[model samples]
Target: MERFYRRDFINTLSGVRNAHLLGTLSYKKVPNLGLFNSVTHIGATPPHLGFIMRPLTVPRQTYHNIKAQGHFTLNQVTLGTYQQAHQASAKYEVDEPEFEAVGLTPYFSETHRAPYVAESPIQIGLELAEEHHIKANGALFIVGKVVEIRLQSHLIADDGHIRMDAAQAVGVAGLDHYYRPEPIAQLPYPRPGQEDKILKPKNN
Candidate 1:
């Protein structure tokens, strides 16, 4: 294991998806949006996920969109969509619509009116459930119940895992470093005497 400490890595390690953060504004009010480095999964049994959005200290678009529409989509961005993902993160003026500015397509979630990235490989429509205020950084942690989920057919795996590497999943480190998939250890991750099989497989 490598050991070095310069600063507590500025990562949004909170459990959530690291996808392109998608949000919807209004009927006549287009949403002011940006991408997030912090996102993750929360539950599987009940099927839920959330994003840690900043508070209303300076008028948060995601928070306001959630409050007004009660809906938002967390879109997972990957290498295939890297250009738009980085382009959308620019802090645009309040009056401009990010989708319009960046030329990204928006899809109305069937489960709710909130919009999602049409070009994204995976998108989840969420209804706001809870807002946790983390005052230290003025970040409002958002919890949403999963009402809908959309994904490209090729990304789903038979083992019930989203082949993240093949999906080209990206991760953010510190303030601005972005990371794509990297090769790690191979599968069959068990050592001798560490097997948990109580019964042997019988060829019938």
Candidate 2:
């Protein structure tokens, strides 16, 4: 396979991925935002999240800021902010903050030094916990502990699952294609000798 084609094929093979806007702040207080599809839930006991970052062959402001500042924000991309979120991935000058260039509002709170996207429906503030550098590729595996979460009260369910459909959260396929997911059904926990039943979809 050709180089570009191989890259695209491997990226999309994992199916749809949650699109997130990662916000960080430089030591100089310059807010930076970047679009990422690699965010993954690591654990719940201590509330940890991990994301894969590209190899730092060049200056990666997000990585630099997170390492230097020790905090970052993970904001869910919504339909309204998907375009701007994608645009945030562009390479900009070290002094030029992506938040200003992409036209997204940068929000800050007393609890965190990093900025969050004001347009994002679900915002998570995290404190840098650990970072692992892959030997084969210089990619960094960043782990952060959740410090704060902000979202609409109605978007969460009693079971703790966020109603993503109601939030209009967007997902990415391959690199550029975006999609909105619909909830199909919610099923009960599996038990021994339990009969299989078709669960009804939630009313959105």
Which prediction has the highest TM-score against the true structure?
2
Clashes of each: 6, 0
Alpha-carbon deviation at 119 in model 1, angstroms: 1.0
lDDT of each: 0.72, 0.91
List, residue by residue over 45-141, the lDDT tens digit for candidate 2: 8999999999999989898989898999999999899999999988888869788788899999888888999999999999999989999888989
TM-scores of the models, in the order given: 0.78, 0.93
Question: Which pairs of residues collide in model 1?
Answer: 16-39, 16-40, 16-41, 17-39, 17-40, 20-77
Query: Candidate 2: which stretches are off by over 4 Å?
Result: 195-204
lDDT of 1 by residue, 1-204 (tens): 233333324243432335565767764668555687666679997987766776676766666667877888878778777667778877776657888777778787545678888877788888888888897977788888988889877887886778778777786664456777675644665578867743575675
With candidate 1 superimposed using the best TM-score fit, by how many Å does residue 59's alpha carbon deviate from the native? 1.2
Q: How large is the C-alpha RMSD of every model relative to the true structure?
A: 6.8, 3.4
